[model samples]
Target: MNKRLVWPLWNLALAIGLGAFGAHALAGVLDEYGLGVYETARNYHMWMGLAWLILAVAG
Candidate 1:
């Protein structure tokens, strides 16, 4: 695969990995409020990664 093509896929994979870690590994580590912030970050990361994936494909 082209290097440009691979980068977005890698980013998406990383985002998913991070999101999973946030949901599973972070449970009980953060308080409710902190967890909310963590969740928000994960959500943004995943969505932005998805956007990157889309852009890569569309371009």
Candidate 2:
């Protein structure tokens, strides 16, 4: 793999890992709306991270 490829790959992995962690770790602690907000943030992070990865590889 290229050196430039590493950052996005790590970011994507981090986003997935963190999203999973947030989902489980905050399940009982946060209320429904709060959890929804957290999930939305996670989803945005995941999407943006993947986008960066794709852009990095393509550009």
Candidate 3:
């Protein structure tokens, strides 16, 4: 694997893991507003990871 891709892949993997954790482990723990916030953060993380991956691949 390319060294440039490692960080991006790790970022994406972590984002995915956190997303799953938030969806499953945190399902009943967080309130509606908190869940919304978590989802927003997760989405941002995922997007940033994707952006990094693209940049790593294209640059």
Judged by TM-score, which candidate is best? 3
Better of 1 and 2 by lDDT: 2
**Residue pairs in candidate 3 whose N, alpha carbon or C atoms collide under 3 angstroms:** none
lDDT per residue (tens digit) for residues 5-47 in model 1:
7877887788889878878988869889988998788788778
**Candidate 2 on 1-59: residue-level lDDT in tens?**
88878988888898889888888898889999999998898899889888988899889
Q: Which residue pairs come into collision in candidate 1?
A: none
* lDDT, candidate 1, at 38: 85
Clashing pairs for predicted structure model 2, backbone only: none
Question: Which residue ranges in model 1 land beyond 4 Å of their true spot?
Answer: none
Q: TM-score for each prediction?
A: 0.81, 0.88, 0.98
The TM-score obtained by model 3 is 0.98
Model 3: residues with Cα > 4 Å off, grouped in runs: none
lDDT of 3 by residue, 1-59 (tens): 99999999999999999999999999999999999999999999999999999999998
lDDT minimum window of 10 residues, candidate 2: 18-27
Q: How do these models rank on TM-score, best leading?
A: 3, 2, 1
